[model samples]
Target: MSFDVICLIAEWAPAVGACRESRGADFYWDAPENPNGEDLPFAIERARRGFDFIEAGFYYEILRRRLPSRVRGKADSFFGSVYHELGPGCPEPPDDLADDVGIELAKHEMYYSMRPTTVRSVLEHARAVPWPEIEHAATSAVMPPRITRHDVRDIEHFRSIVWFHQDWLDEAARTGRGLIVLISQ
Candidate 1:
């Protein structure tokens, strides 16, 4: 199974609250009945500042997940923060988030983990590490002992992931907002 990461910016406190209340898997399901489904309240889609989903950011989640927890925590702070759960009070998503049970089983249950981190904290780690250093680490990061390596160390994939987060971080720093990362497999 492949993984897709959805990076969303909580432009305001209300947005952050919405992220806390939302089901991470909800973004993928937007049937005709659920007209407003694709509109994840926490995510500031193209409506505002031409900001929408960062398609490249999905790889960042995949890269982070491949690394061992030991390497993630200290070696890579920024991406590690994205991998692990953070923030003040994050609510647990409902078990049956999707109306369609089959969809829930195939998607949600397979891998639907969401977490939020304040923009300030994200910037702190991001700012501390130089871009070149981050790139170096990502390319050389070791996978978990049990994980069979594949394209986890691909350079192009690393570049895309970095570009995605760099853009998001720039926006968060400029506007002073929080971020919510949802991983779906």
Candidate 2:
């Protein structure tokens, strides 16, 4: 499965824990129940085991996976992110992009980001990206993006992904704690 990413807090703080609105997650089952019927902790453990199966940061690997050779790099997948926490320590993209099982595992892994500092940096970079201006200009073909040449669909998708991380980072940063990344396929 291809990888989907999320940014989150490193520590589960008391305030965060106390939030009745949400557990800082985009969507999912609650603490006592993970996406699976099992408890969160057990689901997380199982996710970790599944996470250990893939590889990351290899463009050629992506190319090989495509029937028409569509290769998306780590940055491209993260919406032109500068976050480096996702490559080595983070698990690789899954083989089946449609594999919900693998995505669940990745979600658990990224939910508790392993590299909070790096993720923060990535969030900062994403926020700094000129998405708004470029989007407006592109609508008129006035000034195209200079930072990347990804197709319109990829660019748009990446922009949304970056926005998601920006929000997540902002939320976690408020608590003065590091972040965790949740990635699913």
Candidate 3:
């Protein structure tokens, strides 16, 4: 199965919580029915500002290995699993919420997980690594075979995905918004 990494603004916690009340994908797209409940438009705009990177597992693995935990600041050195939080203070979303966003563990090998991190943490981690360094390291990193649904073999393609992630983090820094990291399989 393919892994999709989706980033959403941390401000949408309430909206997310509302939607997650009903498990499965159906609730995620449609806003909750209560008109005065939450600011749907604002949440949507924040989501629009977020990033979605498909099949980036390989590059994630590469960065996870090269980026030392010491410099990760409050951000995770890598993505997380079902049993672990993404990082120290980054707590995993509730089980029902994870299911709603397609991150919950399933019998068909499908799994989804999410963690919230502060804007400062994201900025610290993003600024810690320069773009040129990321590009060079990602391009030169060795990837394990058969680890992902689609393993990226081309260096340019690998660099592009890594760049996309960095750019998203940069945008979050510029906007001064906390981030939610969602990993769906």
> Per-residue alpha-carbon lDDT of model 2 for 1-185, expressed as tens digits?
34444333434342133222353343333445447553332112222211222222222123223312122232333333423334322333221111211233334434334234544565564455444444543344322243333322333543444444566557656645544445566
User: Residue 50 error for model 3, in Å?
Assistant: 14
Give lDDT tens digits, candidate 3, residues 1-185.
Answer: 34544445434455356445645333434546666764344332222111224334434445555654553322343233221333343333234335435545342222332333444453455445444544555666776675544456555665565455455555656655434444445
What lDDT does the true structure give each of the candidates?
A: 0.43, 0.37, 0.44
Clashes of each: 0, 14, 2
Candidate 2: stretches off by over 4 Å? 1-8, 12-116, 136-158
lDDT for residue 77 in candidate 1, whole number 0-100:
61
Give candidate 3 regions above 4 Å deviation. 1-6, 16-27, 32-39, 45-55, 59-117, 130-150, 181-185
Give the number of the best model, judged by lDDT: 3
User: What would the TM-scores of all predictions be?
Assistant: 0.46, 0.35, 0.46
**Candidate 1 residue lDDT tens string, 18-112:** 32344333433441243756455545432211112222233444444544555444335655443323222322222222322223333432222
Instruction: Note the residue pairs that clash in candidate 3.
Output: 103-112, 104-112
User: In candidate 1, residue 31 scores what lDDT?
Assistant: 16
lDDT-superior candidate, 1 or 3? 3
